[model samples]
Target: MSVTREKILELGENLIRTKGYNAFSYQDISSELGIKNAAVHYYFPSKENLGTSIVKTNIQRFEEMVDNMHSRKFDEWQQLDSFIKIYVKSYREQKKCLVGSLSPDYSTLSDTTKQELKRMIDIILKWLTELLDSGRAKNMFNYNDDPTSKALTIFSSLVASLQLSGIVEKVDYKSFCQSILDDLKP
Candidate 1:
């Protein structure tokens, strides 16, 4: 990506995390970057376009993380713990996951952006589904429900937990997630 586009994505991601999707504007990004509104427009013609780009970038990063987790020489449960650890560490540093920050504002987002968000959610869900399926096959997990649905439930809970952590003051996300992991123990 061009430096300008990367800068815009970074600013937009931060602004969206701090202020929410509907709360920030193109002017907000331009002002923060000390650039003109027209210049911001030159990169992203519309707010929806910028929003879609942000979601796409976040999804790409998430996929990369999942890939890294898979490549690690760990057992399935260990990999899941590693994934949760990555989230907790990122939340400790960034205050919110980029995709989790967008969840609440999804209703007001454009169709394209909403679809992008759904795709990101699906990616996480799919990862969980495969893990659960593999674990069940190996007698590592005892769940009987469809893996996809169960995965969605776990994924949704994690996202909600992260968002709740972001809303609280001086919260220990690692502890919160550890409790979640404890509950999901199998």
Candidate 2:
């Protein structure tokens, strides 16, 4: 991404996390970035456009991380563990996941942003489903729900943990994530 685009994305992500989708404006990003509103417009012509771009960028990054995990020689359970570890480490360092932070305000976002967010969720669910299926194949997972639904549950759990960590006790986020992963073990 261009430097300008990166700046916009960084600012927008922070704004969306600290505020909410409707609480932020292009002017907020432009003013924070020391740029013209037209410059922000050049990158993302509308608030919906900017939010869609943000969600798409974050989703692609997450999918890439999952792809990296898949390329490893680890078993499905190990791969899922590694994926959760990545999120925990990221939260420990950055205090939030870009997508995780945006999720709470999802219901109030534009249709375009909402669709983009759903796409991200689908990508995560797809990865989890594949991993869960592999684990079931190896008799390592014994969930009563279908793989897809179980994957969604796991995804929801992870996101909820991150949110709770941010609000309750930031220092306990890693431990909380570890406990969640431990509970996932068969």
Candidate 3:
């Protein structure tokens, strides 16, 4: 892909992750990229088209990162932290997880875009549950219920922290997440 096109997609992802899919326009991306609206259209054609590509790239990069971590023999605890690290990077960049941020726009999104987002999130859930199960087997994590449920709880808690910070004044998502992770320790 062209460098200009890549810059457009990166900016689009940043915009969607921060402002939301509906909250931004091609003009927003163009202005950020120092390109004209027609240049963005030449690459993406429509907001939906740009959004679809961004989601696909996010999913691909996330899956590949997890796969690489697995191949490197990262233990369950390390894998879990690696997962959290991805969200931390997002929080540092825009103060929200990619999927957690986009989820509010699901109902308004195109069907294909919704499916891609769902797939991306499903991968996160799957990896989390697998890590939780492994941690349980190794007695590294403590939870009375099943790993799947616990995984959802962990994910939901983080999202709530993120949303709360966005809603209330100064909720501190990273500190909240670290506190939860501390409690989850055995």
Write down the lDDT of every candidate, Cα atoms only. 0.80, 0.78, 0.81
| Span of 10 residues, lowest total lDDT, candidate 3 | 86-95
Residue-level lDDT tens digits of model 1 in 1-186: 689889998999888877788989988988889999998999999999999998898888878877787687566788678778767776767656667788888788999999998898778788888988887788776675888887877677677776777567887777777875565556
Compared with the true structure, the alpha-carbon lDDT of candidate 2 equals 0.78
TM-scores for candidates 1 onward, in order: 0.86, 0.83, 0.91
lDDT of 1: 0.80
Comparing 1 with 3 on TM-score, the higher-scoring candidate is 3
lDDT of model 2 at position 161: 67
lDDT winner between 2 and 3, please give it. Answer: 3
lDDT (10s digit) by residue, model 3, range 86-154: 666765665666677778888888888888988887887888998888888888988787888888888
Q: How many residue pairs clash per model? A: 0, 0, 0
Rank all candidate structures by their TM-score, best first, as comma-separated numbers: 3, 1, 2
Off by over 4 Å in 1: 142-146, 167-170, 184-186
What are the candidates' C-alpha RMSDs?
2.3, 2.4, 1.7
After superposition on all CA atoms, how large is the RMSD of candidate 3?
1.7
Model 2's C-alpha root-mean-square deviation from the true structure amounts to: 2.4
